[model samples]
Target: MEQNTAAVIRLESVHKTYHLGEVQVHALRGVTLQIRSGEFVAIMGASGSGKSTLMNILGCLDRPTKGHYWLDDADISHMSKNELARIRNRKLGFVFQQFNLLSRTSALENVELPTIYAGIPPAERHKRAREALERVGLGDRAEHHPSQLSGGQQQRVAIARALVNHPQIVLADEPTGNLDSRTSVEIMDILQRLNEEEGLTVVIVTHEPDIARYAMRAIEFRDGKIRRDQEIEERQIAREVLPTLPSLEDADAEEAEEESKVAPGESPAKAPA
Candidate 1:
């Protein structure tokens, strides 16, 4: 492991296996993956395909049975639970299908949780959380609770919380799974913006091909190994920014109506025109 390198995640011959009764279940069999700083990747797999296991390993939440794993020059495969906890708190951010906002907490406070864990001053934490919310176009909803926000808005707040730490990489698991099609597209647009405008490295695990299409590269996992890895074609050339949920709604409604005119079972979310 070299110092000052740009690669944030590197795994070599990683293997993860679990023992169930007298049987052994290999979740990740000899996996190797590397993510450079600023890369946007999507991991695609069916249920029980080891994608989640790999994500856990990358996120430092679980250890591999064998092989080397490095995060920014630190070999973490042998780190103690406390060391892994510290590293996860500092270097990683997470967004889930469920927004996972705290109950009885305002959006601003939800976004402040990570910094609070680091023992940052309250004033500083609030300022950074506010900026993070603004980055995701949720500045006006800071005072609202998660229950008060729409699905997309809640996800935005969750995203803001993830970025509040200025983490080097964001680990997203089924980030859009709970949203409607239009709303899912909206969330993907926000993530793409964060990657392009802020140079945030993002790695998402998803089962939907449409959602995975938003990522720059897609890795397919099958039978505990990578089946395919390649850059995505038809990369979105330009993404439109909407300042509010109403604007997105209006745009989506108009687009859906237009698509309705083009025979049944067709979707206009694929392209605006």
Candidate 2:
């Protein structure tokens, strides 16, 4: 993807502090960064490193305690809760580790949620949702509930939901965390295609080095500050990597072997014993 020089997200000396009882917890300390339009960025850090806090601020889910944030040309540092909600629905899409789909809802209905919040017309919302599902390669599975889909398919539906709103930026927090290695790459492949083919700006928070390599740029956070920011010289192309990974059939066979090790009535979670 050709990187656009225009900055879509800019944070100047951003700081976030939490007051828990009488103690203060500093989540972000004067962190400043810019993510240009059409760029794929990975934010990496260990637990308590504040990467999640930064993502929340960028997604307009939370306001910074100090410093300024400019999304495109508007400064949203002081936007009210309702205003922030409006901006989130209009400009941003989010994917999380949990997939976060409604258990009883079909994938198409799940993807239509953001549009409903945006007050899109019902007819248009259905059309957009179907198109988004097709974009994520889940058009055939649109009527399936989350329970009927595999872990990878579920995440793809979540990705479809994110795209249904036609958001300028997609913010994903540990999007592949719950999946196996091959499935993780599959999710990254979808994100890569979205960025390269659709020209969508992508930002993901991940701790896995292999997953981080899929991003064009990597930003490492530590102790509430950015410790490193650099382009990935040997960026992994997900489409290329996918062919080398274990095939879905192979993964399924392995999974079946593991399931056989557990007694028929026993939960997989208790198989180790």
Candidate 3:
């Protein structure tokens, strides 16, 4: 990807604290970071590490206790809820752990949600929804309800809904948490293909290590601060898993052999962490 250096999300000395009856709960402790446009990023942290808090603030669902946050052109830290709602509906797409589709609604209708909020007319909304669903390879299931779809299909619908708004950045929290191993691969393949083809900026949060490998860079968090950010790269693809592993230069042959022998069941990749 070209290095444009334009930041889509920027945080400066941000802190978020909650007071539970005078006992201060520091969720985020002065975090300063920037996520550039068209970059695939994964944020990983354990419970109470502030990943969720940061995700909420980044999504404009909550205000920071302190700090300056800029999402695109707006200073999001102090925006009114209504304004944040508008921005979220128009500019940000979200995919959550649970497929949050309305059980009775058709895939097309679910995808049409943000358009409805945007006040787009029914005709245009349907067209856009159809196109979005088709992009996720679910065009034929446009009329199916959530209950009628498989786990992967339902998640695809959720992804379709996220894309229906045509937002450049997608915030996904444990998007594949509920899927099994094979199914998780299918979802990552979709996300990876989307990143390569459309250059969509996707930020995902996950605890799984393998899922993190799918991302270009993974940002690890601890105690509300970024601990380490590493680039997990894709290995060179051979047509098939080599029967007899070739020697790796500049790497321990024993360790390389161990890594090479890893089963496909091992990694579904995390946000890259």
Candidate 4:
């Protein structure tokens, strides 16, 4: 298949097979898709539906067993491991379900690690890392370690790490899996801002319909093949939806008030006299 000159990602007849002893597992079968630059895409599938495998191939972390993959007009299916690593560092950013931060390291340090691998100068790395942290609304938390921050803050730090490199595409796998409902929407808001304001291509894998609704396009995979691919007619704006959702802090405060109604060790039967 001929690659599109404008597409950031173009996969043609892509197939991935994993051999386990005598059995061969076919993960993706003939997946041909093109994602234009600055598009927000959500990949949906159940477990073992090949979405993760497709993501790995798209991110240049792994090569397809059979087929052609072009990233920005460059055919990378035949690239060596070293070449792929360089491409990944130069053009790709990844976010995983797990925060993937070092517990003892400060948030700023965690976000700065990728720049070191990218060969950024020490002074410039600090500048970019701090800018990314501030972009994610974590400037005040830069000195705190992972353990000192909440789950959402940790994920924000992870996002800052992803953005510090300023890659063309950001591939996020289940980015909101560990966050609460409100926090998940908040994370989506951040992703939406990055896509809209910075023109970054954003591709995220998520199983939740509510989460997928936030994207402009949705692609569903089933039985190792793309089952459906279509643009959303009326996409829900995360910023608009956020205001309608209940606030997590308010909910926590209400819960605390309810708990305060009763003393910590006081029984219902023993009233203060």
Candidate 5:
């Protein structure tokens, strides 16, 4: 897919402050940044570095205390809650660290949720949800609930849900945090494919340097401001790295071997050294 150079998100002198009792907490300083359409960006920071705040602002979940925010060429700096809700449903998709799927609902049902809010008709919503699940390689698991799936599978379902709306931008916050190393790569591979093949703008917030390397650009936040903003040199391709990592079967076999080493009455951790 051809990359678009138009700016999808623009923030100028953005600042966010929270008042707790008499204390004012400045979550974001005068931050100015622009993310182009069809770009993959990673925001990195520590606990109080303000990356999360910026994400909230970008997602239109909260209003900026001061400054201008333009998303998809519209100034949404001070949109009403109802207006923001409409914008979120129409233009943005979000994935979180936790899979956030309803435990009792089927994967297909979960994916259909966003479309419902978008006022899609029932038949079309079902069709789109099925397509989304297929895109995430979970077409056969449409009837399965979250409890029936593995952590990685659950996250895949979440990704499918995010895509059901055909959102222009996907905002993922620590998307791989709950998965194992190999599973993390698998998730990243999906994200990479979405950006490269589908031309969807991807922005993620992560603290891991390894994870940041998968993005084309990395923005580091410190003390409520952008500390570094630069292109990644020699960026990693997740699909290429997957082949070098051990498979799930290999991991299970290694675990079984370790268990066999333990005496009948002893646990694996208490086995003789």
Candidate 6:
């Protein structure tokens, strides 16, 4: 692989071991990889393949048992828990499979949570949170609670929360796991725009082959090691793909028409989250 001067993440022969009641499990074994700045990459693997362990380490949520892990050329493999927490707040953003937004809180409030933890002033926090929500095309929905928004909209709020901190890399784990196909594409479009227009580095962990097609590169893991690393020759553009998908407005109209057919006092069924 060619060396990049702007390598954002580098892991050298990294390993992670877990000891569960005298049963030892090696989650990652001698995995060496480099992810450059502003690149979108997908990490694909089946269960027990160590991709989740790798993601935990990359997100600074866990440490490698052996070997070096560097973030922006700074060795972090052995950093103290407090130090790692600080670095995570300063340099990384995370989007989980669950939207993870506070259900009762407004979207803007959820996005502002990170900045509050980072010690930003109240005025600055509100400003940044609103800007982040606007960036994700959810400015009008900022006052709405998670329960009021659709699945894709809630995920967009989560993405906005991640961006409010102005981090270097966005680490997303199965971000589209909860949504329908069309909604998943909408989420990917947001991520793609962030990577292309704003030069944000994105690394997503997914099992869906079609979802991985949107990334610039793919890394496959098996038996706790990297089995394949390929630069994608033809990446799908999520923006272009969205236009070809079914419109949410049409779906809403169809649902309302169905609801009208129901007997009085019968509530409409909610869509799957």
Instruction: Report the C-alpha lDDT of model 3 over 152-213, residue by residue, as the tens digit.
Output: 67778889898888887889888888765445566776777677689888898989877777
Q: Quantify all predictions' global Cα lDDT against the true fold.
A: 0.84, 0.88, 0.79, 0.86, 0.88, 0.87
Question: Where does candidate 2 stray beyond 4 Å?
Answer: 1-5, 248-273
In candidate 4, list every pair of residues with a backbone clash: none
**Consecutive 10-residue window with the lowest summed lDDT within model 2:** 264-273
TM-score, candidate 5, is 0.90
Summed backbone clashes in each candidate are 0, 0, 9, 0, 0, 0
TM-score of 3: 0.84
Q: Per-residue lDDT for 123-163 in model 5, tens only?
A: 99999999999998999999987766666677889999999
lDDT of 4 by residue, 120-165 (tens): 9999999999999999999998898776666667778899999999
Off by over 4 Å in 3: 1-5, 235-273
Model 6 regions lying over 4 Å from their true place = 253-273
93-145: candidate 1 lDDT, tens digit per residue:
89988778885689999999999988899999999999999999999989987
Q: What is candidate 5's CA lDDT for residue 6?
A: 89
Off by over 4 Å in 4: 1-3, 250-273
State residue 90's C-alpha deviation in candidate 3, in Å: 1.2
lDDT of 2 by residue, 1-273 (tens): 322248899899999999999999999999999899899999999999999999999999999999999998689998999999999998999998888888779999999999999999999999999999999898998898776676677788899999988899999999888776777888999999999998999999999999999999999999999999999999999899989975754647456435523432221221121
lDDT of 6 at 56: 99
lDDT of 5 at 257: 35
Quote each prediction's TM-score: 0.86, 0.91, 0.84, 0.90, 0.90, 0.91
After TM-score superposition, the amount by which residue 182's alpha carbon in candidate 4 deviates from its true location, in angstroms, is 0.3
Compared with the true structure, the alpha-carbon lDDT of candidate 1 equals: 0.84
Q: Candidate 1, after superposition: displacement of residue 11 in Å? A: 0.6
Lowest summed lDDT across 10 adjacent residues in model 5 is found at 264-273
